[model samples]
Target: MAWTWTYETADGRETGRSAEFETRSDAESWVGEAFGELLEQGVDQVRLFDGSDEVYGPMSLHPA
Candidate 1:
């Protein structure tokens, strides 16, 4: 299954999506590297998916 990410706003509006990845680890790594840029683009949070199944997240870009 392809792994992917959906970028969202603080209010839960989806604003963007990521390129499909071959593995969940790759998807997570990509998000780890890109979250800063995503925040600059107005994405406050992100969700990970394994095809149609949600793996995790609504993870915030801000440090907590």
Candidate 2:
């Protein structure tokens, strides 16, 4: 299944997408590498998906 990450703002507005991946691990790894810069650009949360199915998260990028 193709995996992707949706980047969003704190209020749930979608801001962008990560490059598509063939596996979830690659998708998550891409997020790990770029999440800091994404947060700096005002991405407040992220969600992972396999096609239209959400795997998890609207997870906060900010430290709690």
Candidate 3:
């Protein structure tokens, strides 16, 4: 199992997003330390995704 980071942005009617990461802890730390600043500046959302099948589905800190 690996952790992935994802971000979503919609600016002026255009939607864009990205995802990348090798560890869940790394992703969460980045979001808490860096992405939170982006949120203050208008980023849509920063979230973590677990690509493990043991969970049976996408698991997020926030229910998803």
Candidate 4:
């Protein structure tokens, strides 16, 4: 199945998604490289998904 990432604001609003990937690894790598920029752009958290099913996250960019 294809994989992707959905963004969320610090206040908990769901934003848009990144481009889809052929593998989960590709998707996670993209997030690894780009999450810092996403944080600067106001995305506070992110979730990885396989199709519409969430595999994990709502992971905060901030330290807890």
Candidate 5:
């Protein structure tokens, strides 16, 4: 399975998603660790998406 990072702009109309990662855990961890920096830099929001099931964050970051 692979993982993807998605971010929606503050406007809520614009959205961008990243490429897939080798593992979901890696993806989630990367997002978790990068979120603060992104937010600090002015990112609106960050979310993790699973390529396999199309599930979003809150689940991706959950401990497995």
Candidate 6:
């Protein structure tokens, strides 16, 4: 299945999305590495999806 990441704001509004990944791990890793930039671009959270099915979501980009 094609894996992808969806970008969002703190209030659940979709802001953007990443390019399709070949694997879930690749998608997750991309997010982990790019989260800093994403935060700078006003993306507060992210969601992972396998095709149209959501795998997980709303992960905060900000540090706890």
What tens-digit string does per-residue lDDT give for candidate 4 at 1-64?
8898889987778988899999998998899899889988889999899999999988887768
Please provide, for model 6 over 1-64, each residue's C-alpha lDDT reduced to its tens digit, 9 standing for 90 to 100. Answer: 8998899999999999899999988998988899899999999999999999999988989999
For candidate 5, the per-residue lDDT at 25 reads 77
| TM-score ranking, best first | 6, 1, 2, 4, 5, 3
- Model 1: what TM-score? 0.95
- For every candidate, C-alpha RMSD to the true structure in Å: 0.7, 0.9, 6.3, 1.2, 5.3, 0.6
Instruction: Name the regions of candidate 2 deviating beyond 4 angstroms.
Output: none
- Top candidate on TM-score is 6
Model 2, TM vs. native: 0.91
| Each prediction's number of clashing residue pairs | 0, 0, 0, 0, 0, 0
Poorest lDDT segment (10 consecutive residues) of candidate 2: 27-36
- Candidate maximizing lDDT: 6
**Residue-wise lDDT of candidate 5 within 1-64, one digit each (tens)?**
6678776666543256666888877776777677766666556765666664656542222233
Against the true structure, what is each candidate's TM-score? 0.95, 0.91, 0.44, 0.89, 0.59, 0.95
Against the reference, the lDDT scores of all candidates come to: 0.91, 0.91, 0.48, 0.89, 0.62, 0.92
Residues 1-64 of candidate 3: C-alpha lDDT, one tens digit per residue: 5665444454322123335557766766666666555555556654455773322222222323
Error of 2 at 48 (Å): 0.2
Better candidate number, 1 or 3, judged by lDDT: 1
- Candidate 6 stretches with Cα past 4 Å from truth are none
lDDT of 2 by residue, 1-64 (tens): 7899899999999999888899998988888888889988999999999998999999888889
Q: List the pairs of residues colliding in candidate 5.
A: none
lDDT string, candidate 1, 1-64, tens digits: 9999999999889988899999988998999899889989989999999998988888899999
